[model samples]
Target: MAPTIPGFGYRRVPVADDVALNVAVAGSGSPIVLLHGFPQTHLMWRHVAADLAADHTVICPDLRGYGASDKPSETDGTAYAKRTMAADIIALAHALGHERFALAGHDRGALVAIRAALDHPEAITHLASLDVLPTLDMWDVMHGTGAAVGFHLYLMAQPPGLPEQMIHATADAFFGHFLDVWTNNPQAIPAEIRAAYLSASRAAVPSIVADYRASAGIDVEHDRADRDAGNQLRMPVTVLQQDWGAALGFDAAALWNAWAPGLRHTTVSCGHFMAEEAPADVVKAIRDLLARC
Candidate 1:
């Protein structure tokens, strides 16, 4: 069962191809769509969304397979590709009667937002990605020892049956590991929230694995094509990421600059779960990003 939090209301709405999405929308003003990352749902944005909703109409949805959204089985691995997922968001925005809107995504959702800014440039007025790099760059930067920081990336990148079987066998541990490791303040994500994420992941194991699998395959191809085509995100882009440079020996800003032309990059001291770990800082970043736009 999804957690029922106050100051937010839930609704099931149709986006692309008549697919229904479980979205938590609140506040009222200019439209802003918030997309959550992997191993979690839109609830990750609960605090941030509420803060934004005080001034803007915030639309937080469980992207297709995560949270309470429709988890249709994938026919092909490409079905969960970021490009397809980005389209679902575009359709969601259109369904909400906004032809164009600002988009902010965290982790996996950041990849989707970047894809949306690339594929549907006109539809995304501004883009903000938290704690991630583009898929291709991410793959390129991974080395022998440095790659352990994202072991799950390779594990989930495996083909169909293997990853699904392995992950499902230890679903609680798989999901709980991130909940424990990714945040500076574990208490920020209470026992119930952690359990909620674990439950969602267990139910959507196949689709979740397929989503990551696509990152190693089709998602990389799309990024390569975009790079070859000289397709930089034309909109104003803001990125708040942990300083991976000093720790991981890669310049986060330099990597983001390749894909985002009008870019403003800042490194936050917080852990991977920036939205949950540092809601005030995240909200300030969003407000500043929107102000610049």
Candidate 2:
């Protein structure tokens, strides 16, 4: 079950030929869509969404395959490509009565937001990405022994069959590992939310794996094409990420600058789950981003 977000009501918003996402919405001002990451649902934004609800209409959605959203079995591995996921977000906002909106994403959702901002710049007025680099930069920075932190990225990047089989065999343990390792504060994500993540992850094994697999294949191609074509996120963009580039011998801000021309980049001390682990900071950064826009 998805955790209850205070002052937020749940609804399903249709956004594609056949895809509609389970979204939690609140407030009544200018729209701000918050996309959740892997191993978790829109529930992760419980606090942040509530905080923003005072001034913005917040739309939090479980990216198709997770939470109560419809999960279709994949025929081709591109089912959960960020491009497709981004379209789902765009259409969701449109259907919600917002032709354009401010967008922010954490982790995998950040990948989707990146694609959305690049693919439909006019639709995303202001953008924020928490604890992530773009797809191409993500691959470029993770190399050699230090990249072991992202072992799951490599494991899930494998051709569909085995990654699916192995993970389904121990879904809770596999998904729970992230909830365990990625956070500095255990209390931020309560026991109930953690259980919700494990349950949702276990129930959607194949689609979730397809989501990961697409990043290594089609997602990379899209990011590379954009980079080669001199595409950048043409919006007021703020990025709050752990300085993983310091350890990996790359410049995270400089890399993001290559993509976000008017970028306000900062390295936060929070864990990967910044929305939960450091929500106040996330909210402040988002407010600042939106203010400038």
Candidate 3:
């Protein structure tokens, strides 16, 4: 079981279209919104958020289509676009009375946070992205055997109902494979947290697939537009990622540098689930980034 941390409580807040999000909020200082990656919920930040909450007001929310949040039907594919999801975060923050705040996201959340910073630069003070390349870079770089590593991305990006149906057909194996493979430290995610992730992912299959599909389509277009317009994140940015170049034959830092001019990039020894696998190191990185900001 995931060890319980005290002082954390869940709240349901309204975002767009009267959709309510079940967010886990804790601590009592300047606000920091935490976003989770694909196939995971706010629970991914259970360790890091609790630690940050000791000194900062931390708000970890399940993104619109994930976790305990409202899984609204994907209307016109724009619904799951990071632009809309980022807006949801901005609205969620505003609802909590924070006109401006720091933001950090892991996996898919990292993408959403970056989108928020680019689209709503005036609303974010500092930004941190964990373990993801910008959408355009990601799409441009995938090729041959290197591309095979992210097979799920391609599979999930396929049209409509198929990806969801395929994944749901083998839901446990689909989600469990990542839970077992993505972490450097398997024990980092306890039984309860693992079970929670599996349950939430199984429940949000269609919405989750819609999210990845958006990345392959509209999200890529948005990223290209931003690159063409020379739009980069204005806030101080920190990116912590596993060095994919050493194994995957790409310059990870160079790609991030193209998007974030004021960027601090660090490679951690942990696998994809850095926050859970290496909480102390992740916490220190956040503190160092916050200090610089």
Candidate 4:
């Protein structure tokens, strides 16, 4: 059987006609949905979700096109846009009987969470983003020699066919590379859970690439439009990140502050997989975000 968050009940929620997300839910009271990052599933939240579930209704879902969730064909650039994925998340919350809730996401999931908070401000009471910049700022900051670290972003951003074919040809190596390099505490991901993440990612290459491809195209466009319109996230926000700004040559707090007026920015000393590497810190950050909201 697949490894799962202990004590959490599972559900297959239909967020759209073509997409149904695999969700793990627990606890009660105010809801908070957690979206997983690239090369991972909702399982990444096992430690954090379990902790948050003590009081909040924790909803962790395998976002569309990853893990056990439905992967609709990426017929167009917009098909995998963060805007579209954000809609799926909103729909998932509505279907779960939540009209408004707190939201937190990591990596690619963070990008989607940012989009959701931007487009549906009324529905998100509190927001937390783990280890990523907003779409437009992400593209803007990723230039010069520093950008070399995100080679995969550019590789996957290419025209669909080659990126899909190349990644599919060596899926495990491709997915496992991130799992190995992006974690400060490798032991945080035990052998069994690591295997589960690898298997799930290996089976979802094309859709995953399409998801990244959208970031380079449609997602950026949407963010640019919002930026031009002077739109900002109208909710309490918490951003926990590695000191990527020191290496990447940007002020992480200033960037997030531009998008979120009510923001709390923190720099963690863990690797990209902070949710696993430093689950306690993540839980504290989230709990703090909830209190402020």
TM-score of each: 0.97, 0.98, 0.97, 0.99
Candidate 2 weakest lDDT stretch, 10 residues: 1-10
1-293 in candidate 1: lDDT tens per residue? 56855688888988766468898888888889999997899989988988999999899999988888887787866678999999999988898889999999998999899999999999988899999999999999988798998999999887678889998899999888988888888888888888889899889998888888889999999999999999899888999997666688888888889888899998888888889888899999899888875
Question: What is candidate 2's lDDT per residue for 1-69, written digit by digit as tens?
Answer: 346897889888888767779989999898999999988899999889999999899999999888888
Regions of model 1 farther than 4 Å from truth: none
Task: Write down the worst ten-residue block by lDDT for model 3.
Answer: 1-10
Residue pair clashes in candidate 4: none
- lDDT per model vs. reference: 0.88, 0.90, 0.90, 0.93
Deviation from native of the Cα of residue 193 in model 1, angstroms: 1.0
For residues 26-77, write the lDDT of model 4, one tens digit per residue: 9998999999997899999999999999999999999999999999998767
**What total of clashing residue pairs does each candidate reach?**
0, 0, 1, 0
- Best candidate (score: lDDT): 4
Q: Write the residue-wise lDDT of candidate 3 on 1-293 in tens digits.
A: 43234578878999898688888889999899999997788888888988899889999999999988999888798999999999999999999999999999998999999999999999999999999999999999899888988999999998887888899999989999988888888898888888889989999998899899999999999999999999988778999998676687888898889888889999999889999889888899898888875
Candidate 1, which ten residues in sequence have the lowest lDDT sum?
A: 1-10
- Which candidate wins on TM-score? 4
Candidate 2, 272: how far from true, in Å? 0.8
- Candidates 1 and 4, the one with greater TM-score: 4
Residue pairs clashing in model 3 are 37-108
